[model samples]
Target: MILLKKVLLAFFGLCAGGVIAAGVYAFLAIIGVFVRLMGKTGTRKHIFLYETVIILGGVIGNIMDIYEFPIAIGGFTGHLLLGICGLSVGIFVGCLVMSLAETLKALPTISRRIHLAVGLQYLILALAAGKMTGSLLYFWQKMASLG
Candidate 1:
């Protein structure tokens, strides 16, 4: 029965992650437009990093949910706590990316890059982040289940 519940929870959590990612994408789309309109192109490089962080957070939350962290603790409050931690991690990732991006800005050839390349760059970042986080989660679950 517990195994079944965990499976169901994992399924639901994955679904929720997709929903959250979509919602964040929509929100980011709006913010991107707003920023561009406001002539804030200077911050354009950071936008993709923020999006990557949000996607990573949602995915990490989904994985954490597979272990039923919220129920193990209390309930909604535990979920909130987990969510906050995920978000804090995400923000940290974004800050790191932002800092690295700033350093790259000094490259004379960076301006020659095509617009479409930015999309690819973020896509790669998201994929890499998700892959690493999922693998970490898998190992964590394995170790946890052994105990």
Candidate 2:
């Protein structure tokens, strides 16, 4: 009975792998573009600092996502592509933050308010990307199971 249950679950997981990878790729690509465009500089220090935090956090999240999901990433080729996407987006975010941060520092007029709004965007995205990457290679796994 237990053996039968295991086989059934494996079957479903295998079938779902391709769908999951495709879905994840679409999501990551969209979010990456959105994240890249979010680097707006404001006259207020609080807003400046806030946007900086958000961009930096997102870049960090992308990196962590790559590190956290090496297995089940379809194959070496797939993993490499995913990493490239993450790095491209991350670099874009980093450049934005660095440029804006420089502006904030150069300004004499800037807010001193506490800025912690929407700082977890990257963390959440990272977790999601990791899950997608980790769930990939469903087809590969199913094939391996046959051997």
Top candidate when judged by TM-score against the true structure: 1
Tens-digit lDDT string for candidate 2 (47-113)? 5665576557655666676468554557667656766776666656555554454445632222224
Candidate with best lDDT: 1
Off by over 4 Å in 2: 1-73, 106-147
lDDT of 2 at 73: 52
Provide the TM-score for each candidate, comma-separated: 0.30, 0.25
Superposition error at 94 for model 1 (Å): 18
lDDT by candidate, in order shown:
0.61, 0.55
lDDT of model 2 at position 112: 27
RMSD of 1: 16.4
After superposing candidate 1 on the true structure, give the runs of residues whose Cα lies further than 4 Å from its correct spot.
31-41, 45-50, 57-147
- The sequence of per-residue lDDT tens digits that candidate 1 reaches over residues 1-147 is 999999999899768777887886575454343254234446566767755766687677767765666556555576567667666666555545444454456323453554453465675578668966885687568646754
lDDT of 1 at 113: 59
**RMSD of each candidate relative to the true structure:** 16.4, 17.0
- Clash count list over all predictions: 0, 1
